[model samples]
Structure formats: C-alpha cells, structure tokens
Target: MRTTRNNNVAISCCSSSRNLVYKIKPLSHADSKRLLFKRIFGGEESCPSNLKEASTDILRKCGGLPLAINVTSSLLATRKTEQKWNEVRSRITSAEGIGSHMKHILSMSYFYLPLYLRSCLLYLTMFPEDYEVQKECLVHRWISEGFICGKDGEDLVELGDTYFYELVNRNLIEPVEVDYNGKASSCRVHDIMLDLLIDLSNGENFSSLLSNKANLARRIRRLSLMGNEDEGIIEQLDVSHARSLGVFRPTKQLPSLMKSDVLHVLDLSGCRGLENHHVRDIGRLVQLRYLNIHGTSINELPKKIGDLEYLETLYVDPGMIVLPESVSRLKRLTRLYVGTGTKLPDVIGNMENLQELRSINPFLQSTSFPEELGKLINLRKLGIHWRTSRSVGSSYKEKLVSSLCKLENFNLRTLNISFWLDEEDDFIRDFGFPRLNSVRTIRLWVGKFCWIAKCMLSHANLQDLGIMSGKIEQQDVETAGSISTLAEFGVFPACEGPVTITSRGFQQLQEFRFTWFNGLMFEAGAMPNLKELALTIPMYMLNYSESCFDFGIQHLASLATIHVQIDCRAVKAADVAALVCVLKSMAVAHPNRPALKMRTICEEDMLPDE
Candidate 1:
C-alpha cells in the first residue's frame, strides 16, 4: 500500500499493473505541457503562444500522464538532493577497500598529525604492527609519564575508550570492522604511515646513537644498544648522538649518553649487573620520554631521578634496591613497570598524570596497597603479581582479590599468574579473574583440585589457557561436566571423569585430550564432534578390563584423528575387534572423516613390572 499526499488517498499498488507503477505519482497531462514549456523557453518565458500549441501536439504523440496536474519546484529540489547524495556515497565507497579501513587505522598517527603526537606515535613502533592496542594499555602508558590528565570522577576503562576514539577521529587510527559486540577483530596501517614511523625512528637528520664500542657516541635519531653474553660481547658503546636509546644487556656497565640531551626512550631489560654508575648519568638526559629498567640490579635510585621530569615510561626491577623520595618529583612520568623486591612509594600514585602501571611482587606484598591507588583515575593496566604460598591463606588474601575486581573490565590481552598451593582445593575459592573477559590467553599455576577449573573453562573470551600441572577428580569432573562448551581450541593438563560425554554434549567439542585417566571404555556417545582425541591408559586397570573384548574406542562418528596409549598385552582380541567395529562405523557415517593411525604400548615393555 502506498500513501499519497494529494488528497487522503491510499493506493494498493501490489494488485496494479507493473507498467503503470512507474507512472503513479508524478504523471499527469497538464504537467507534461509545463515540462515542455520549461525545456523550450529555458525558464526565460520568451516562446510564442502559437509555437507552444505546436509543441503540445508533438507531446501528445509521446506517452502522456494518466492524470493532469500542475508542475511544482519542490519536486525538482528533491531530485537534485538525491543526485548530490549519490555522488557523496560513491566517494566514500571508493576510499575503502578490502581490509583497508582497519589497516589504515593502525597507523593513523603517521598522517597529518602534529610533530609531538607523531613523536609519541612512533614509540609504538616497538610492538608488532596490527597488534591490538588495548585502551587500558595505552592509558596506563600515558599515566606512567604524566601525559594524561586525571579527572575527579572518571572510569578508568571509559577514559581509555575515549582516548582511542579521539585518535581514530583524527585519522591517526582507523576504526576496526567489528561485530555488533564492538570487539576488534583485526586492523592494519597504511604503507605511508609506517614509513613515517620509520623516519621518526631513524631521526630526521643527525646520525643515530648506536655504538661500535663502549664510551663512544655517534649522531643518530633512534638508538638501540645491546650487551650480550656471547663470546664477542661489546662491553662499552657510545650513544651521544641518539635521541632515543633502548638497551638490552648481558653485561654490567651502562652505556654513557655522550652528546644527546633529548633521550626519549631508554630500556635496559635483563641488565642484572647494572650499578650506580649506569644510573648516575641518567639524570643528564632530562628530555627522556620513556625509560625501562626491567631486569637490572641497581638497588637504589639516585636523587637525580627527579631531573627527568619529562619521562613517560619507567621500568624498575627487583634489583633496584630502593626508590628515593625524589622519585615522586618526576611529575611527567606516566607508565611504570616494577619488578619484585622494589618498593613503590604511596606518593607515586599522587602524580595526577600517571596512567599505566605494571608491578610484580617482592614490592606489592611487602607493603599494604595504599588507598591512594584508587585516585589514579587515568590508570589503564594495573598489573600486579603477589606471592601466593600454601601457608599464606587468610582474609588478607581476599582483600587482595576484591581490590582488583573493579579493574577486571579493562582491555587486557594477556595475563600471567604464578602461584604455589600447598593445600588441596583452597586457592580456587579466593582466586578471582572474572573481569578479564577481554584476555585472549591466560597462564596460571595452581594446585590440583583447586575447584576453579570449572570457572576457567567457562571463561567466554579465553582462546588459550595453560595450566602447568593439576588434576581433576572424578567427582569434580562429573560436577563440571565434560567441558564440551569450551571453544574449538583449548589445552589443559590431564583430566579425570568417569562420566561419559553424551553425543549432544560432544557435538561442539572439536579438540580433546588428557593424560592419566581411568581405564574406562568410552561407549557410543563419548565424542561426536571430536576432530582430534588423545588419551593415556591407566596401568592398574589393565588386568581388570583385560578380559573385556576389543580394546579400541567406538561410536565417535566425527573422529578424524586419534592418539591413544593402550595396554594391549593383557587385553583380548575381542576388545580390539570392538574398537575396529567403531572405527568402521565412523568411516561409514562420515566418509570424509577418514581412519586414523593406531599406536599401542604393551605391559611387557614396562620397567621390571614396577
């Protein structure tokens, strides 16, 4: 049904003839005469009346409107607007191509940005291109340097998102094509943008600050000096000419910055042997923008640390024995990474410009977390690692956990937790990682039967989860089900569950494997969606089920691959036959799934029957 404004007429066009459909609204006999006059006189109105009559006769020969109506200027304006809209649409379409939108966004800062912004942008060149820059990760970085402004009442994660959008609108970063959920799937940078980063890294004109030997400096823009334990270790190098210097070392001495006053970046990760001599001269580079001392041994920071007010990133290792009161004077610092054994003063959080933070213990656990930590509204990633030993279970542990709950929603891609448990099933109750929905991978070490495996399995965003060592008891396994709801890709330590997986439950499970499980024959609905399956047979159950016939698994219709270690010596041929039958049935059901190779181990091969 179509509605018309002329009178209050509603037309049911579905039943009408297709030929008259195009002539519905604008067609009319009088309108045709007006169109002719307008085309002939060109709106000049100089045509004669006699000539107009002749034109009308010619128009009558052409197709005429179904009804007569007067011409109006409103219709003409509508058509012109439509034409301009079409042109604008075409230009937008031409500017985009396959994956170009996201690629261009990754390096948006390289194009048409101020020099200061570009200088900051080039610092990201250290990471892999197209790497997802979490809003929290960037904010934390800004906070460590005192670059970001702190607000009285701002959500940390929201602030990070706002910053990211601002950069995107400036065409310094491209927005990724995401799903309705707003998760970034992929991104890339334009070639021209990357070239600009390269130029910034190399410095505009002067030589870069790389050294051939120690104690000598050369003119350079971006300088990375390294010390290695290899036989040809270069102990000393001069970087007087470089503007940014990052050092990775296996030696003791820190390189002297000869002539450069504007050192923007300085990283000395794994420099365990660095001494006071290395940091004494650091104050000379006042323009430093980023500084990392991740794995160094210098215990005490000199009072001159305050001189580098422009520092943006600072990493201190456990080897940094003590932080001076002057450390709080570096108001410009935004991002800071602290290793274990180093104490961070409460005043560190007082710096309103601070954003990103990564701190590991020896420091955090040694002292109570200052309430001032909550004041850094600009903070993005507040990475902290603390000791979790067996005897340390208490309410204090719960406090440590609840304090971090608010920080869970931040965009973090990787999280690593290292803990030791002396008691059974005690740690899981206190462990909390609910807010890490954006983390792609997690590496955790906890005691077996901690009871948190269920929670870990249910995590919605985890693509990779590694548990160094743990066990799942049969009862706990039954409680947790077969974990068929897990994503297509997952890895974990061995699991134990006497409960069998039903066909429906296994339908979505793609990869499955475990070590040290009970010797229970998997019946027909064990693993229907199994693309790959691996299992280890228990030694004690060999004699009990050895009498049962056919040792192979059956009924896994979707099984494309199988890896099993079976104790076939005590097993009868009937068991092997049963296994073969299942395999044959699967081959018949899914012809393309194909058969798998079988590998077996015999009890005779066991060591002295031990």
Candidate 2:
C-alpha cells in the first residue's frame, strides 16, 4: 500500500507481507547547517568566520529540510559576502510553515537567476516528474521557444548548452547522464524542486498543467495535460492565447487545433492514437516554430505541413511512409529528425537552414537525394541509411561518393553511415567514401571488415568508432590500432573467428568492446593504455583448450577493469567453473591485475544434457 503525506512525499509499504513502513523525517538544525556549509565550501572547516553567524540563521528557517539547505548553499556559493548571506537568511526566516519555507528557498534561487536562465528553468516544469530530459532535445526546444539568448559569433546551440549547465550548477536540476566529452546528455528535476516549479509556474502564469478538468486555467499560455482524464476539457477552454500545447500521455483523439492560430510549439510525441485526420488542420498554425509527432501512427504527413514557414524543428516517427515535398517550403527548419526507413523528399536541399538531419532513407537511384544533401552546407550532424542491392550500378556509387565529397567544407562533427546490404552484395569492396576530416565520431554499420580500415585511414582525427555486423580480420585490427587519436572502439562482428593483436597496437585506445567474437588473443604490448575491456562471447567458445585460451591480458599495463558476459544455455557447469578459475588466476598473477567481473546471460532454453 502507498499513501501521500504531502504532494512532495509518498510512503509505501507491503500489505501482503509484514507491514514494515519506513518514514523520512526532516534533518536537525545543526546537521542542516553542517551539510549546507560543507556543500558550499566542500568542507565545514573551510567555512568563513564572517558567514558562520548568517549560516545559522538560514539553517534555522530551512525547516530542517535537506533540499532547502542544499539549494540555499548552491545559491550562496556564487554570492560570497556576509551581507548577501544575511539577506538570504532574512528571507528564509520570514517564511511561515514547512511548505512555505521550501517555496521561499526555491523562489529565492529562482529569482536570483539571470533572465535568460529563469525562463529556461521554468520551462522544465512542463515535463512530468522524473522525466529524463535529453540535452539536445531540450536545447532545440529552447532555441525554438526564443528562450536561448544569442551571442555574437556563437552558435545558438552552444549558448543554450551554457544555460543548461548554469541551471545544473544552481541545484535547480540534477544531471542524469554526461557524455564522454563531459557534456550533460540528459537531466531530471528533483521532486522538491519540481513542486516549487509547479507553484511558481502557476503563480506567474508561465504554464498550466492539467491533470483533470478542474486544473485547467481559464487563460493559459502554455498547457500540458497529464493523461486522458481531462483530455476533453481542452475543447471547452478558450485556448486561443495558448502558445504551446503538449500531451504527456496517449488519448483517444487530439483536440482540434483550429483555434490555436498563434501557437509556437505543438508536441504530440508518443500519442499512439494520433491519426492523420487529427493533424489535417496543422498547416493553419503558421506561427508554429516547433512540432513533434514522433511515435504516432500517422503514416504520411499532410501536404499542408509546408505552410509552417517558421517551423524550426520537425521530428517524426519512423513509421511515416513519405514526407511531403511541401516540407521544402519550411525555410526556417534547422533540425529535422525522422525514424529509420523514412523516405525523404527530393527538395531537402532547399531547406538551407538545416543544421542536423538524421535517419534519412535515401534511394541510391534518386539523383536528387544525394545532390540536395550536398547543398546543406550548414549541416553539422548527418546520418544516412542506405539499402544496397547487387543491382545498384557503379555510377550510383560514384554519385553517392561525389555528393558526400561536397560536404567536406561543412565541418561536420558527427557522421553515421549505415548500409543494409543484400546477402550476396559486395558493396563494401567498391564503395568509395570521401574523406571527412572534421568528423570526431564515426559509426559504420557495413558488411565487410575492410570498411573499418578504410574509415580509420580516411579520418585520422576520429575519437570514437563503432563497427557493427562486419567481419574483423587481423589486418583490420592492425589498421584500427595505428590510428593515433582513436580512444574508444566497439565491434559487433558477423562471423565467429579468432582475432590476434600484435605488439604496439591501439596506442591511444582507452576502451575496447568485442561483441559475439569467437576468440581474442592479445600479444605483449598490445592495448598498453587500455583502461576498460568488455567481451561478450558464447559459452561454447570458452571450452577451448587451455593453450588456445591464453588472453595475454596481463600485457595491458594500464588495464583497470574487465567485464565478461557468457551466453549460457548449452554451457556445462564444469566448463563454466573451469573458465572462471582461469580468469581468477590471471587476475591474481598479473603485475597490474585488473578487477574482473563476470555474468551469465540465458540466451536460449537449456539443453537436455545440461
């Protein structure tokens, strides 16, 4: 059973078993002050003498809540003075009750934000609790909503990223995952902070959250419905002034957008019931800047979509059958994302404002597809999926390579090229890929291992490379190792074969992963700087003779951790024990022994012999 104490807190217990309940009480005043001081200064001993007296006053009014104390500390970390601390202390003490204290503390933090950051933080309240916000998606939304401020000579996306980090630093939001480049890839709002944001948003009329009909505001600018409970209420309200509208959950049908003429954003992502008829009038929303219909059941886009000349971002699900050529009329479209297998329009080149275009299914015979792609000079990130067949002529391959060569001056940072080749097709042998020097990350899903070697030779500055569904050979491994800047490498081979690594390979590689490889042999001085290694192989491969199982992992001087996943369905208990013993012995005998972790995955039904 579960019950809500306050809207911010929930208590749960097992009713079928012994009813043992656990509750969390507020922190003590002394403990709260200690935490606040340590959080701000990184140590209590470093707390300034002048701020100690003011810190006590602040902690006393925090209602002994850790969230309040932490948010206050984050605010004070920036303003380092006795006067500033006293001001915050006075504001906290003036609050009346527990709820009032939290609101006051959070409001203080919110009010202290720069104007640009305030809108960005408030917009986050539009999302549901515990929602993992993707940094790129959020930044694009901010840009489309006019929340991001532009700096001369700086990209708008980069400026929006700075705003995101500022909110994270202020303790307004928590980071979920950071990328390898130390950039926040996703984030979430704390429950306490979310409560504060809801209140603040309502009071300021920044946005309206409708869970039921009664929660709908009469005069709202932005609206997000929690579920289908109050979906009908949308038609009853006068949403002519609504600038943004979102449906967080699936409903039977979407309310007509005929009245929302001044709308800026219409996000119906993941609404399974969305039909083409529901969006038939979407073209009337000429002012719409951002539109997302991903994961919906709409098979084809309404031709009227091109009427949205101001549309900057368009995201559609992969199930979409065709994109209307009218989309070329959206001159302001900067970021276009479609799911896999989406046939793109021929006028893609006219949208010169596109900075990111992904998952485009291009027909090799369609000369317009590649030619228009080459004209997107502003494109920074590009992803293409090509379905290759034996019938594809040599002229088509040359045209594809020539079109890609025109993009060399675009300075693209990320490139993903995947080829779904027919079983009998040997496209990898004759494919000529132009050199893209600016690409930092290159992902190739091809049929042959030689393609990986070609990519490594072409892009010496690649920091990360992922090869999938390819045949890896010894020379291919040698080619990958010689890349001076390669740091991370992952390969999912198509065939089971032995891979041998000679000395002095993978000099700068830090992480290596081999998925479904039959066997791996590392000679001395190979992968000397490798820090993390993961091997996912079948259990039958581990039953080889002891001499064939010499992994030479001890040669990895900088190795720190190794993870092994064994597919265990036909594996015998004794064979598993023997393999575990060998790994344990290697870990113990190595001069720089790495931590070893192993797990078994049941891939199939157990055999009768087992």
Candidate 3:
C-alpha cells in the first residue's frame, strides 16, 4: 500500500491481486458538515433551524474537503443572515478556474472581504512561503504601500495592527507569536491560501513573481524575483512601471535600477549578489520612499542618494560604509538604521523628520557629535553603543550627558544603551542619566546596577526592564520589585552573586527571567502575581535541600510554569536523578505547584568507566 498527501487531498494508491488499482475516497458529506458547523459556531452542538438548510447547501458545495469547509465557515461566520449565506453558496458553486475544488472556496472568502481588506490580504503574497512576518515590518510595509490610513485620533501603527488582527480573525493568516500582553507579534499564511493569492495576483497584474522571467507582464506594479541569478531574463523585462521591486537569493550580480524610474519600495536585504555598482544610479529613482539593503555587499552609499526628496526609510547593514554628507538633504527621512561602525555625516541633525535612530557608535573624533544628536527633537527611539576607550576626557562625558538631558524633553519612549567599560569605570557617576517622562521601556548593558535603581524611581510608567550588569545587590532587586507598574523583567548572566526577594514585592509582574545567578531565595509572599518563571543556573550552585524547596518555589502561588535549565558538568547522574525526584515531590505537595519543565545540559563527559 502507498499513500500520497497534497494540499486538500489524501490518496492511497494500491494494486489488488486481480491487477486493479484503487484510489482512496475523501471525507463523507455528513462528516464534512459536522466539522464545518463546529468551526462556524465555535463547537456548538447543533445549528439553528433557520440556518440548517443554508449550512447543508454550503457544505455540499464545499465537496467534503476540510480546507474548503474551514474557509467557507470563516466567510459564513461574518455573514449571519440566511440570505447572505445563500449568496455566498451561490458564488462558491459558480467560481471557475483550475483546482476549482479548493480555489473556489478560498475565492469566495476573498471576494466577500471589504475592499480595503482585499488589498491588504493581497499584499501578503509578496513574502516567501512559510515566512514568519513580524508585526511591525508588515504594518510599516502596509503603511508605505498606502493600504493603511488612520481615521480621526487613531495612530497609524495601531490602525495597521487592527487590519492584521482582522485578517487573523477571518482565518486567512495564522498567528505565530503573542507578547505577554496578548498582542500578536508575528504571523504567517497557509500554503493553500498563498497559492490562491499568487494566482489572483498574477491574473489581475497586481504583482509579478519572476523566477525565470518568462511570461512577463507588460505593466507590472510590484515585482518579486526569486531563486538564483537570471540576469538575461531580468534584462529583458520593462521595469519603468514597477513601483516595488524585491530580489531574493540572487546568485550573480543584480541588474541596475536606472530604468525603474517610478519605484517606491526597493528591498534587496539578503541578496548576496548586491554590489555598489548596481545602486550607482539609485539616486535617479527620485520617487523612492523605502530602501533596504541590509545584508548586501555594498560598502558605500552614493552621494547622489541625497537626491531622493521623498525617501522616508533607509536601512543598511553595519560595516565601514562611508555615508556621504549629502544624506542630511533628505528632509523627509523618518527612520535611519546603520551598522555599528558606520560613520554619519555631521549634518545628520538637519534631518528633522527622523524618529528612530539605532546603534550609533559614539567614538568619533568630532567633539560636536553628541550636540548634533541632541538636535533630533523628533526622535522617539534611540540606541547608542559606547566604549571605555572613547571616554578620553571628562569633556566627552559631559557633552554626552548634556545631549541626553536635552532628549528628555522630546517624545522619547524607548532607550537602549550598551557600554563596554573597564571594571574600575563607574557608569552611574560619570554619566548623569537624565530623567525622562515619556520613557517606558529601558534596556541597559552596563556594569552599574545602581543606575537602574535611579531609573526605576524616575520612570513611574516604565513597564519593561532588562538589565545585564555585574553583582546585582539585594537592594537592586528590591528596587526592581518595588516598581508597581513593571510587567516584564529579565536579568542576564553578567549579574553576579545571590539575590533575595522579600515578601510583598513585584505586585504586578507577570513574567520574570533570571540567568546564571548564584542563588535565589524567595521569602513567602514574594512575586504574588508572577505567572511565568524561568531560571538558568549551574548545577553546582543549587542547594537542593528540603528547606530550600519548601520556602523557595511553593510560595509562588500564582506561577503557571517553572522552566529550569541545569548545567550538569560537576554533578553525577545519580545526583541529578535525586534532585529531579525531590522537585517532583515538592510540586506534587504544593497547593498550586504549577507545571514544571526541566532540562540538563552536560558540560563534561560523565559516563561510567567501561
């Protein structure tokens, strides 16, 4: 016996002794309707009398296929009336095309969506199959493509998120990751849905997918080239009308963009064949708005890049790329992201529209660099990388702190600063961290934990805090726990020594993570509201006494999960087994023990002698 499984079909190929072949049948009509009704009404036992006839007809038209039934049900969930259901049934029965069995069912769902939603759904086809789309990236693209327009008092990012959730609610896309606040962070489309979208996109000339460049559309608006180099095919196409161009997995050098005068979004982020020469004429594409060359080989941005009057976003990978001073000419630029060591023109402060600037290496010889950064009044998110060697004199430190003080008046909400300083250097004393009202998220990678204590007291609205420091004292932990508004907190390995949490701390924290800590002692009633706890500690440091287990974890009444990673280089297998047994017993004894997940990582060979 042999079996084959395709998108909506499962077939069993078999040859009988009588020399006859037989094909397996699909789901029976009764079974299909049962599944469809369960999904449409959210597992309700029976359908209403008024909709019974409509449901039966809809299921019969779906042909007893699971994918068809689910897609049909998603569409029906929106249109509650019997008349609307009958209308959808009629359309599904009449849709014509290859693979009509599945295509028609999906097409009915697409056509029934609102006009604005249709464009948003079609835009998803540009991404590769099984790609996990980041919520921010997708929303930004939608806004750039003119698909998202906020109404009165609505922020554009919030509005875009609404559109994304709407698609998920309609069962068109699958949600991959949701944050602690129950907000989706990433999503993906089903393979069958992608196929239908590709077909519809090509048919309408709404977008083009170039694999070999055959059957090129006369006037394509959006073009996505996949697979290896096919310069011959790329050169033959007329790209003057293309508004967006993307090249994926290019094996050889890419063609120039001189002919594509009307391009708006150009993304060649991971193309290995990208070179400086290919983008020499990029300045001529004056209509460009979004450009991403993240993982390419280009070493320098042409001086003519300043010619793009309407460009809003510029993203490039980190390297020694020499950005021309003319970049300050882009008055409309909103987001500028570059590598760690990339040099910025002194006139960067002239780009008044900049909102997000990441990873500025502040080691330049110019003393006025920090002053220029202070002039970005519109900046919302700022990331700076500082090294001890750059701190030549007190003058640099004074200027840096002065610039940060000016930023406090702006609308900055997120701040990430990483420091590589010697053990003797005091981060908190040298840099007088300014207090900001709008800042809510703070991430620090410095040696001083004292600075964090000051920030916690300063930023009352702060919700997320991440600290990677050395020797976090008991007072520092107490300070973090005292923040009534904190929801998520993470302390990485750089932190040394044991930390104790007293009773009645962390009133609102839901998630807590501790890595490479010496020990953790929780007084009863500590972290009363924490839902998730993760600990990564070396096995040698754990004091597996009965009292330790008795007072440590059993007190976390609200914990739903305890994930423990134990490093087992210094302990024997028997000792590890004994520890696991004790932990299991403790969990079984607690009132609200929560689910326990533990893993052991062997750092040395511990096998018995042969």
TM-score per model over all chains? 0.47, 0.83, 0.80
Candidate 3 residues 1-610, lDDT tens each?
Answer: 4433442223223333423334446579878877877887755476667888888777777776777777788898877788888788677664453356688788778988888888889988778888888787677667667887778745566788999998887778888865545567899998888889988887777787775243374577888777744678767777788888777675455545777788888888887677787788889998998888888887788989999998988888786456788998999888888876888888788999888888777765256778888898887788777665634666776687777768767756666666555655554544445665555666666556674466456765777777766667677778888888888888875445567777757888988888754567877888888887877756665665545544477777688776777777666777667767877786677688677788888846444423
- Order of the predicted models by lDDT, top scorer first: 2, 3, 1
lDDT comparing candidate 3 with the true structure: 0.74
Question: Going through the candidates in order, what is the number of backbone clashes in each?
Answer: 44, 0, 1
Across 153-172, the per-residue lDDT of candidate 1 in tens digits comes to 46444554555555554444
Quick one: RMSD of model 1?
19.7
- Model 3 C-alpha RMSD vs. true structure (Å) is 5.7
lDDT of 1: 0.50
Error of 3 at 538 (Å): 5.9
Span of ten consecutive residues with least summed lDDT in model 2: 10-19
Worst 10 residues of 1 by lDDT: 66-75
Off by over 4 Å in 1: 1-218, 226-241, 252-255, 271-273, 318-325, 362-370, 386-402, 405-419, 424-444, 451-465, 474-610
